[model samples]
Target: MSLSPFRSALAASTLLAGFCAAPAFAQHERMSVIANGEKVGFVDVARTGNHVAVQYDVKNNGRGPTMVEAIELGADGLPVSWTLDGKATFGGDVHERFLRTATKAEWSDSMGARTATVRGTGLYIGQAASPWALGLYARALLKAPASTLTALPGGQVHLDKLGPATIGNVSYQAYAISGIDLSPDLILLDDKNALFAVLDTGGAVVREGHDADVPALADLATKLTAKRYAALQKRFAHTVDAPVRIRNVRVFDPVSGKRGEPVSVVFANGRISGIQPLDAVASPSEALIDGQGGTLMAGLHDMHAHISLESAILYIAAGVTEVRDMGNDNAFLPDLMRRIASGEVAGPRIMPDGFLEGRSPYSARLGIVADSEAKALEAVRWYAARGYWQIKIYNSMNPAWVPAIAKEAHALGLTVTGHIPAFTNADAMIGAGYDEVTHINQLMLGWVLDPKEDTRTPLRLTAMKRTATLDLASPRVQATIDRMVAGGIAHDPTAVTLELLMLSRNGVASPSVAEYIDHLPIGLQRRRRQAIAPIASSADAAGYDGAMAKVKQTLKLLHDRGIRLLPGTDDQTGLSVHRELEIYAEAGIPIPDVLRMATLGPEQYMGRDQELGSIARGKIADFILLPGDPTKDLSELHRISMVVKDGTIYFPSEIYPAFGVKPFVAAPKMTLPAPTPKLAGSGPAHDAMDEFVY
Candidate 1:
């Protein structure tokens, strides 16, 4: 999924760290935040006598955090007291405080309060820290023995010195800090160890007057990230040369909603060649995989995803072999797809949806942004020429232009799907030729909101409270459902995203992530336990709860009325897709049907079921090996032992650790064919089989 406007703002906050200094008087510095080549925000820092004060404000696409921070540094250059007060990415109140003493430390933020006894020293990773905090952590780690320090709460922080880099006439040293997040945060420092710039693939926060180098810095960041993932691909991706035989496995047939008898599935050249009886003999030259009586089913599909280098591998690890990229950076996505196709990266097969947003203050910076009706049509043609599967209209789009845009897209044989633009309703979009609606809130908000209430802001989320009291049986609600059914409009509810927003609470894991939150990295674990939607009172909390129930109720209502429901999670982690399936089943859809929606349903919807989706003769081999039948229990989807996509086999256990995730299950035995003997004249046997053993 694309970064929520809120998260985009939050990530922007971490793009720059302050320069370390102990001025006798006072010093000041300023930095600019650039995202996708656009100046979106700024960071200002004032330091006086070991005390630092910062004001960070960012406005990109009309929404960003405006934070004020105060910090007192100890003699060791670590934060002794820090206070942050501001509005979060979605306008949620942010009041975080952290204090460290020689004996102990205490802090309280949105995730609630905690205290830890200090031994010698521990770095407190602030939940809502400003960019300056990065410098604080970096300076402390550089001074520490081995350039490593224990982080409060949990985990450790390690720093590695990357090679030097130069921007313009100035030379700088680069460093990478790991363990604080899934991907290492890369920063540049001058000879004095003063932070100069913080680089990110999406953007960069560079020292003032150096903004011209943002693109170069971002390119460096992307190359660094690509290099890391490339290494991982080399280490984890296993390519099979000979025909592969997966023996002793029962296949779950989504078409019949039943498990077939144990069979030996054979595939060659990335296509399933046969489904033989368990007693069938295998060729000695074939690679043999003992399934150990597991259930093999079609690999799951995440219908809504925004592919990133990190999420790409995570998707494969979670048994998601196919993903429909709802939206993405126009240039970056195709290159990523190319890498995955060339085996330079490990990722799912991508079906990209061209993202089209109207030019507005709140417009998201992805895909194509059009300012006029002519530009909108041009964007449609652009996507058509590029062969986008569909055109996804975003919140800032003009409702008046959707009809023409949709018409143009239809003429070019591209389907239209997306958020209900501000001031417009789902009914209007469907009439305008939207084949599908993107989010549950986008569809339901039209019923609960005034025409003047803009959905381009967080109101699209907080307004869900109004849905708690909405009558599903009312005429207006039924009319929209009827319109959807009549128009064959599909819904990509992304219910898990809404659940994460509305139902989340401080110190409480949202039900959507409760099952596997513990398996996530420490940073993500903390985030999952925090609230995204600001709850002001008991009434507000209850309203959100009731709203979630109504969301499920509305889903069931749509299902009953025969409106096709597409299972999707606007979440990148492949785990959320499984939760999305659970939510669908909980919404009264049958377990078997939910599995179908995740497997064959999306493939059929995308018109690729002929060569993909299920495990059958002549079809591409994209399936997962699991310990239990997902048709009976959707939760079993998480326990994937093996995933085979286009004949490339991946054992989750072998890769999960690379991301700091504990293995869910051990990989079953896979015996490879013996390498061929080389002739005396030949230097050596050079077949791919001689490269490695699985």
Candidate 2:
């Protein structure tokens, strides 16, 4: 996953590559990182003698703590050395070091040792360079005239000048820096080529004096990225193609947890129209495509997605066709949904979930922040008026006020789900009218914590170590389970998060990501191998193992009691959801049941079963065609041949390259009629596998 604002600030400062700025006199340049008008962190830039230095310091209180980075550039404005020493989102110890010389560059990061030869004037550095590096890199690119430069650890960096932009009263020259993922990270420069501001996907970084201008600048950045993705969607989505009929595929029955007999499924105009016997021949007018005896199943629903347009595309490419956004920047989520709905971008259908939290210094800064019961009710009415299907409470919320908040939300027809507030337990929230609990940790933490322990800190996570010895049959645990069962309370365990937190050890590749990490961009792949929680000794490792086992045991018990389990990845998008399902399977839930939880379970919970979550005729044509049956081995879901979302086709092979990922499979070969009309692009114009654009 792309780091959160605080992690992004501490992780890598140089997300944009190849751009260089003009040399400036020795001075300090301070930029404050702001999210939703709240200051989360800051980056400091300075040039002393012949070296350019950048430093970042931020403590997101409950979120990202102990994030610090130091970077130094050579006289040529290229990185000479850099290090990011901090804790990852799940509290992993991050110690990334990079050193460069004239002939070679060396790096020791989360993924271990890596080296690359010096090619031309290109600098091989870690991705953590500062925004100031953009202008300096631009200056270098202007002189060299190269489209891409190789990074030391691996991957190509593409840079482009987007001309000029004027935010508020200030004028600026704009440039886009991207490395894989088609992320057009736009950084703005003043007339003197000084790094004035950087607008990333969700938030922004502006000079300290310009803190108030973050919203406007971030909006501009969001639009530029949107336009870039819009062009990509237009170029890749296939809407004008002939009706597609996929024949000779086994359909997965979520109801029965088995694959039905081979069948022919045909759909167009965004709705399934027919399901014929596998032996039936397609009409001459229909475009017949061979499934090669693959399995066809409904596209998945990510019940706890904190969505972004980029993640949305990744989800669709990974066969997750629907998402229910758990929490996000109030300003960003609505517009992103609007773009997706208008077909200006390619993504899964989104169900917006309003995030409600109490105002506190350690509060998660997204969503509506309320300080009193009246304000909480006001937030509920606001979300209801705007059509939010559900409201999610957060850690800093007052336990005493949850009843009133839940009552107002329920009265307005919104389902209530969220973290059990600090100093409270799952049973208290369930009794207060919460219909669901958000995470497995939230449900289990109460059984282990003292009444005074505050969850608004890392203690909420670290306290999980105590769960290793928890007794599920004890009155304390059984009471919560009994209440949840009787109240029809659903659980969005986000089990992969627990696995990442408790089971991952430093230097040992996490099993949850080992299967697909290598397929991601180098930056992400490297980060995935790092531990989330440091294991100090054999006892610590054993504690982690025991803690993870208890959580798995909790999941199994909840399922046995008929408490609904909704599979969701609260971590990164795409393959993480796949891994979440695998965690479920490891918890002893059958493969078919896991698949059902990802597909039909959330749909039924959200009350959208009539229009989605199935492959029957009249349902929305949202499903994936995989090369193997997932019923036998859930891993087959990763081998997606094609994903049809709302009747539009997307090929993972074509989309992967945009993000610097090697395609997992060859684009499906298609049989077309004579005089094949070519797509407007150059590389391969034969419409490989009928590649479509939105």
Candidate 3:
């Protein structure tokens, strides 16, 4: 231990020589290149009985030299551990992490997750969120998401529906998805190929569809392939270019009144590249409007929408630009969001909320109700861990448990909003720290003003004079408003549903009805119409209608009283969301204000200012162009002829535009001659293409 000077010098000299040689050795690291451009190099831990038979695909991108790396094996020659080797054949690390998945036993048992390695393609397993990936590999492998990526130029990547697979120790089923892109978290791609894109922000994932192609889209993609595709390789690069111009339009500035003058809106590099002076921002890239004046405004936004792929089509067809889904179901929320963002699904931008609800034995679809503060905190943390935008509270939550829930949600940076229990009104909920209240009906159900007004029984409560409609002008209403102001609680007062609830059984008549309903396709119309009947003039129906109307008016009154009203439609589809805007107008709210509700209100509520809401510079390109000015008549909302959700233009009118393929020829009504000689070809398997006669 004492005489070490000479010994230390020799040891240091040996270590220095090793360090210098290490870099040189790493430069020649031996590795094997399997398929898909994956080069794994690693040392052999052990060897098998027979020849080392390794099967893998080779992906040659027509560039880059072939690289060979060590591919570690598991039991039965499966591609288990993989690493990029440096220096020698069985060398040092070269920066590659192949997560080992778990067995299926863990998944089937108590653990909700399991991981297993995929044999053919390592990619299917590597694309999962880390935890899920880890859980999967260490556990079992079931199915892998389909690896095919198809597109209409620039679109989103969805978890293609996949079939099942079996690992050595476990089995699983890979859930499909639409879109996934997250930052700051490892994507866990398990053996089942479940991928969770832990997003850095809450944004809609939208997609276009299998409809006819847009010529302009072709022009754009083909035109900018190089610069744009490079951007594509980067997650947050500026991906789309603004078209030359938008022609022939009416304009509705959310700040402007209805029946306002026409104006042109122009966009460039994802901004109001230009709002042309008063008229249309006409350019050769776009077509001019041929009809008389119509309404033009920013596209509508649905605060809450759910699972239907049809909902996305309905939203686009109806011109709803954005949709904020309130709950998750069917593994649908994430996939739906991704698809929308990817342009794989023709739909609106989606904002998703991990399901939240009162903890109950009856788990209603997405119900996750909680009875304790600790549970609420845990729930918030769990959702935040996933990529949910907000904490959507639900009905039947215990009043006493609200404050604890609110505290936990706020701590985790989630906005809490939903139904308040009957026993506790808006004041109690907000004072307890609720950030927002959804649906206006709940606001008026309180018994504060008329303390002795037989509040318990439904009949008694209905008969009471202190209904929300009455309380709107009372001190109690203002008090609630003051408290909301103090607590900064916003209201997602859905106008259309409330109006429909009021006009519940009016034989479904009204000219404005078509103004809203016309946006929907015939099939959707047929379905909604079916819900209209078996009409009977019963007092119960009358009272329900009255209460509904009162609720609508009550919401309007709240709006009148300076409460920031967010336009929300608990519509499963986008059809009703746009209608809600018009309904808000019918209730005497200004047309400009209606636009603001869909734009500014919810944006403010989510506290996502830098990226969303206004059609301003630097905000994510999410807006619509109208053919007419909606400020004149809310019906003009129907004029959303073009939409740019997430900067990609979705022109509905031209989605299936004629490509000069064929013209319709009306059949002759006269009795046709029977069987014109079975086509003289002697029927030798004639080709359908050969049948054409110009």
lDDT of each: 0.82, 0.75, 0.43
Point out where model 3 deviates above 4 Å: 1-242, 248-251, 256-265, 276-296, 361-363, 367-373, 448-471, 506-527, 530-537, 608-611, 616-620, 654-694
How displaced is residue 456 in candidate 3, in Å?
Answer: 15
Error of 2 at 285 (Å): 1.8
Question: Over all chains combined, what TM-score does candidate 2 have?
Answer: 0.92
Backbone clash pairs in model 1 (N, Cα, C under 3 Å; residues 3+ apart or in different chains), count: 1
Top candidate (TM-score): 1
Question: Please, what are the lDDT tens digits per residue for candidate 3 over residues 418-497?
Answer: 76553567788888887888766566665333333322222222332224236466687778877876776778776565
The most accurate candidate by lDDT is 1
Evaluated against the true structure, the overall lDDT of model 1 is: 0.82
Lowest summed-lDDT stretch of 10 residues in model 2? 9-18
Off by over 4 Å in 2: 1-10, 14-22, 51-54, 65-73, 83-94, 111-116, 125-145, 180-184, 240-242, 672-694
